[model samples]
Every structure is written in C-alpha cells, then in structure tokens.
Target chain A: MATEIVLISLLKILVVVLTILTCVVFLVYIERRVSAFVQNRVGPNRTGPYGLLQTVADVVKLLMKEDIVPRNAYKAIHDLAPIISIGVALSTFAVIPIGDTIELFGRQIKLIIADVNVGILYILAITSLGVYGITLAGWSSNNKYSLLGGLRSSAQLISYELSMGLSIVGVLMVSGTLQLDKIVQHQTTYLFGWLPAWNMFLQPIGFITFVTAAFAETNRLPFDLPEAEPELVGGYHTEYTGLKFGLFFLAEYANMITASAVITTLFLGGWHLPYVEYVGLSSFILSLVYVGTFCVKVAAVMMFFIIIRWTLPRFRYDQLMNLGWKLMLPITIINVLLTGIVLLILH
Target chain B: MGSNGKIIRKKDLNFWQRMYIPEIAKGLRLTITQMFKPKVTYQYPDEKFVPPPSFRGRPVLVEEQGVERCVACGLCSRVCPALAIEVQASETELEKERYPIKFEINMVRCIFCGFCEEVCPEEAIVMSNEYELVFTSQEEAIFGKEKLLTPIEKLRPRLEWLKNNR
Candidate 1:
C-alpha cells in the first residue's frame, strides 16, 4: 500500500512537471504569434508549420551556445541564480488543483501534487523567493545594468507582494480556508441558486487587485521593468548566455503558467463546469470533463496575460511605485475589509 | 493651458480616464480588432520587389546594334568621384571612330553615385534597374566592357527616365 502510494505520487509529479515544461514552450510560441497579430504583422510561420517548433529550435540553439562567465563575476552564484528561478517557478504548481479528486485503479486520488493545508501560503512564499534569483543574478554578474534591473525587480516584488497577499486575503475570507482545493470547492456552490459563487463575483475588487498584482509578480509587460530592453539591456540576465539564459527565459513563462493556474483555481471556478453536475455523466467522463474545463480556464487567463502585455506599455519606474503603493495596496486592503464584513453578515 | 502650453497632466483627466480601466478597455478593443485584420508582411525570397525606372542601380554601358555608344571621351572616368571607371581609348572601324579597348569599372570602388552616368556626354553609361550585386573576390567585382555592355532594349526604361528627368 505504501509502495503504491509512492508510485502514484511519483507519477503525479512527473505528469505535472512535464505538462508545465511543455506549456512554457508553447506559451513562448503563442506569445510571439499573438504579439505579431496585435501589431498587424505576420510572426514566424516558416519554422515548422506556423512556427510551432520555434521555441524548440530556440532551446536547441541556446544549448549549443558557449557558456561565458565574466572574469570579475561571482561564478558560483551566477550559475545558481537561474536554477533558483526555474525551481521556484516550477514548484509553485504543486498546490494548484487542476481537477477534483477522481477514482483511478480503484483508489481515490486528489489532482493536486501536494495537498498541503496551507497551499495559498506556500504559493505566496515560493513566488516571493523568485525575486532573489533576479537580485542575486544582478549582483553576481558585476554589471551595472544588471544590478539596476535586479534592484528594480526586488523593489517591484516588495511593493506588489503586499497587495497580492491582501487580495488573496479577501478571497480567503469569502472561502474560509487556505487549502487551494477547499477554496475551489467553496466556489463550486451556487449563489442565489443561479449565479456561480466564484470569488471573481463575490470579491470583484480583490479580483482586480489580484490580477494586477499577478501581472506584476510574473514580470510581464507594463510591469516588465526588470527586463526593460531599452534601458536595462536584457536586465538581470544581461551577463547570462547559453543554457543559463534559457533557464531564466523558461522560468518566466513557467511563472506565467503558475500565476494563470492559481488565478483559475482561486478566482475562477477551478474545474467546475457550471450546471454540468445535473447532466448525469458517468464518474470517469465527469472527471475528464472537469480537467478539460480547468485547462480551458487556465488557457483563457494566459491569453489575457499575453494580450495585456502587447496592449499596455511598460510603466515608468515612479509610476509603477505609485500604482503599487498608493493605489493597489489601499484598494486591496479595502477589498479584504469588505469581504470580511460581507462574510460576517452572511454567516 | 496657462504657461504649460498644450501638455495634459494626469489630474486633468476626468474621473473615468483617471480610473484607467475604461481607457485600458478601449486600448484592448483596438488591439483585439487589429489581430483579425490582414497582416502587412512581404514574404521575401518568394516575393521580389521590382524597382521602378526612377531607381538608380549599377551603371552599365549602352550597347546599340552590336556596338557601344561610347566615343571613348574619358569624361565618365574623369567625373567618377570614386575613380572606378577606367577607359583606354583605341581606334575602331565603327561609325563612332573612337572605341574603348580596355573599359573597366571596379565595382569594389563604385559607390552607385551615378556621377559617371551624369557626366557622360554621349549618354553611353547609365544606371540600370539591376541592384543585386554580389561578388566573392575583388577580381570578380571589376567589370570589363564585356560584362558592362547592356543591350539598348534592356536599357530603354532607364534611358527614357534619364531623358525625361534631365
């Protein structure tokens, strides 16, 4: 029984990791194509059917490049930074429930890799650690531009992390739990017998603040001051080449996927297809449908991320700080208070 | 509006604009609509861009009825800012009397300035529409009379353009 449990856990980890890696590869391709479309120009379509294998080609090319280390650089720390970045970005997926518990091999299994009671806390903690990677990379590279980028990123994360956490506090108050699966399960219930009790509806201000903060956390455009090419010249990864640079690139998209999945699991209904339970589908088919629904929700959120990146210009440094501290922070605090009051009254 | 000229401050934006969400929505709508619109990419290699007669390309000597129009005046060589043209005058049995025995233009030195064409009194040398110039070696870049002579029919558009423009 113990062996079986170990094997199941291993299988789940393997599946989750592989899925996240593949998603990162495709996300890069989709981002390029979508950005091209937004600008009224055709993107790379020549590299294997609408540039589907473009990211794959890019990875192979990155692998072949020479690993250059500056003479004045802290060699060990520089090497370790991308690994830290990639590890933190990928590990945040462990607590996100893609689908509900399902029967497999005559045994019940939860879809989440790690069923930690404090799932939301784990995600918040892991994502915050992502800044260390950029900061260390900047300091270790011994480059002025890289140092500035690293400093900006750390500041940005600090400013935004508060609002991000507070926004989630609003969701937590409504859901009454920290476990991601439980939060999703709470959202599965109907409000007023017709409206789905997704946190997006229950705490609209929290949803907006959370999404904005997620964009900042992911270091995407508008909040992508870390790698602002015009000023920073590839930012913290300025001195990075070959596979180390590739790892940082992969970590970014992986972070985007993690953010999207978390948003789906929290604010959106995780794997719940509204009114699907009444259709009377078989258990196995129902589970499959639920997984599909989860995937679709995540994809939609990711598409929103990509479109917003192209649509919005990067925030000036002062503007970013003002928005984060002055605007988002207060708004999220208010959202948390409002959510607590509503929950208290309803109960 | 006072001393600031036409500069619009953030405070000047009325409520909805200051909120930024509604303004962002408008921007998103514009971008999303642009996504479905026709792309403006020209697939090169598969699709070539043909230059018009007005375009100044590589200079060529006009060949008329199995003979060059050049009277070996050496004007184009003297006028060439790049000193690319080399004319060695020699007597010919043709009606022009004087012909270039060793007429050569070092493309390595040629700047495509069209000065040689502009100064040619006989209108013998003119800029053609052929711009694809590639050479592996310095020797290959030096065009002798054999390589420089282009038939009058092929030079018609350029010759006509020069006639009208001049």
Candidate 2:
C-alpha cells in the first residue's frame, strides 16, 4: 500500500512537470507569433509548420554555444542563480489544483501534486524566493548594468508582492480556506441561481489588483523593468550565455504558465465546468472533461498575457514605483476591507 | 487646449482616461485589430523581390553580338568614386578598335553609386537588377571581364529606362 502511494505521487509529479515544461515551450512559440501578428508581421513560420519547433531549435543552438564566465565574476553564485530561478518557478506549480479528485485503480487521487493545507501561502513564499535568484545573479556578475537590473527587479517584485498578497486576502476571506483546491471548490456554487460564484464576481477590486500584481510578479511587459532591454541590456542575465541564459528564458515562460494557473484556480473557477454536472457523463469521461476545461482556461489566460505584452509599452522606472506603491497598494488594501465587510454582513 | 500656451500633462487626462483599465482595453482592441490585417512582411527566398528597371544593382559591361560595346574609354574608371574599376586598353581589329585587354571591378569597394554607369559615354556600362551579391573572400569579389560582360538582352529594360529618363 505504501509502495502504491509512492508510485502514484511520483506519477503525478512526472505528469505535472512534463505538462508545465511543454506549456512553456509552446508559450514561447505563441508569444512570438502573437507579437508578430500584433505588429502586422509574420514571425518564425519557417522552422517547423508555423514555427512549432522554433523553441526546440533555439534550445539546441543554446546547448551548442560556449559558456563564458567573466574573470572578475563570483563564479559559484553566478552558476547557481538560474537554477534557483527555474527551481522556484517549477516548484510553485505543485499546490495548484488543475482538476478534480478522480478514482483510479480503486483509489482516490487529488490532481494537485502537493495537497498542503497552506497551499496559497506556499505559492506566495516560493514566488518571493524567485527575486533572490535575480538579485544574486546581478550582484555576482561583474557588470554595472546587471547590478542595476537586479536592483530594479528586486524593488519591483517586492513592491508588487505586498499588493499581490493583500489582494489574495479578499479571496481567502470569501472562500474561507488557504488551500487552493478548497478555494476552487468554493467557487462551484452559484450566485443568484445563474452566475458562477467565481471570486472575480464576488470581489472585483481584488481580481483587478491580483492580476496587476501577477503581471508585475511574472516580470511581464509594463512591469518588465527588470530586463528592460533599452536601458539594462538584458538585465540580470546580461552576463549569462548559452544554456545558463536559456534556463532564465525558460524560467520566465514557466513563471507565466504558473501565474496563469494560479489566477485560474483562484479567481476564474479552476476545473469546475459550470453546469456540466447536469449532463450526467460517466465518471471517467467527466474527469477527462474536467482536465480539458482546466487546460483551456489556462490557455485563455496565457493568450491574454501574450496580447497585453505587445499592446502596452514598458513603464519608466519612477512610474513603475509610483503605480506599485501609491496606486496598487492602496487599492488592494481597500479591496481587502470591502471583502471583509461584505463577508461579515452575509454570514 | 494648447491656445492658452500652457502644457497639459498626462495627469490632466479626464476621469475615463485616468481610470487606466479602460484606456488599456482601447489599446488592446487596436492591437487585436492589427493582428488580423494583411501582413506587410515578404517571405524572402520563398518569395523574391523583383526591383524596378530604374533600380541600381551590380555594374556590368553591355555585350552585343558576342562582343562588348566598350571602346575601352577608361571614363568609367575615372568617374568611379570608390576607385573600384580598372581598365587596360589595347588596339583591336573590331569596329570598336580600342578594346580592353583587362577590365576588373573590385566589388569589395563598389558602393552601388551608379556613377560609373552614368559616366559611360558608350552606354557600355549599366547597373543590372541582380542584387544578390556574396563573396567569401576579397579576391573573389574582384570581377574580371568574363563576369562583368552581361548579354544586352538581359539588360534591355535598364538600358531603355536610362534612355527615357536621361
């Protein structure tokens, strides 16, 4: 029985890791193609049918390039930085519930890899560790530009993280649980007999603040001051080359996928397909449908991420700081207050 | 608004614009609309660009009936701003008696300025519409008479264009 449990856990881990990695590759391809379209140009269509294998080709090229370490650099920390970045990015996916618990081999299995009761807190903590990787990479590299990039990234992430955490408090109050799966299940009920009780409807301000903070946390455009190419020249990864640089690129896309999944699980109703239970499909088929619905939601969120990247220009450094502190922080605090009052009155 | 001679800042944006999300939605709508529009990119190698007759490309000597129209005047060499052309004239039995014993154009130095073509009184030198030039070495970029002498039929469009315009 113990052996079986261990095997199931291993299988779940393998599946989730493979899915996230595959999603990262395709996300890179999708971002390139979508950005091209936004600018009225065709991007990377020649590699494989519509440039499907472009990321694979890019990986192989990165693998072949020479790795160079600067003579004045702190060698060990520089090498460890990308590993930390990718590790934190991938591990944050463990608590995100993708689908409902299913019966397999006469045993019940939850879709999440780690069913830790403190799932939301785990994600917040792990994602915070991501900044350390960038900061260390900047300090270790013997370049002024890299140091500045790392500094900006740390400040940006720290400021946004306050609002990100504060925004999630509203959802926590409404759902009444810290576990992500519970939060998702809470959203299965209806509001006024028709509307899905997604936190997005229950707490609109929280939803907006959370999404804005997520964009900043993921270091996406409008919040991508970390790697602002015009000023920082590739940012914290300025001194990185070959596979080390590829790892940082992979981590960025992987972070995007994880962020999208978190957003879906928290605010967008997770794998709970609205009104699908009434259709009465077999248990096995329903489970498959649930997984498919989860994937589609994540993909739609990722599409939004890609489209927004090309639509908005990067913010100036002072402007980014002002938006984070003076605007988002205050708005998120108000959202938390409103959610508390509403929840208290209803209960 | 500018008639008052005062600068209006982005901060002065009315309530709707200052809301930020609605303005962002507007920008997103514009970019999404652009995505479906016909792309202006030309898929090169698969689809080649054919330049007009007036386009200046590589300089070449005009050949007529298996013979060059050049009188070996050396005017093109003199007019070449890049000093890319070299001519060694010798007496010939043909109607154009002053034929070149050796004519070379160092493509490495050629700037595609078309000055050599413009200075050619015999109309023997003209820029053809063949722009795909590649050289692995400096020596390979130096074109001899064999490479520069292009058939007149292939250069007819450029010659006619020059006649009408000049």
Worst lDDT run of 10 residues, candidate 1 chain B, spans B1-10
Off by over 4 Å in 2: B1-11
lDDT of 1 by residue, A37-120 (tens): 999988978889888999899999999999999899999999999999999999999999989889988888989898999999
Error of 2 at A213 (Å): 0.7
Write one digit per residue (lDDT tens) for candidate 1, span B94-158.
Answer: 77799999899999999999988898889999998888889999999999999999999998988
Question: What residue pairs are clashing in model 2?
Answer: none
Predicted candidate 2 versus true structure: per-residue lDDT over B1-166, tens digit per residue: 4779987676667898889999999999998999999999989998989999999999999999999999899999999989999999999998778998899999999999999899889999999998999999999999999999999999999999999999
| DockQ-derived CAPRI band for the predicted complex in model 1 | high
| Candidate 1, superposed: residue stretches over 4 Å from native | B1-11
Docking class of 2: high
Q: What is the C-alpha local distance difference test score of candidate 1?
A: 0.93
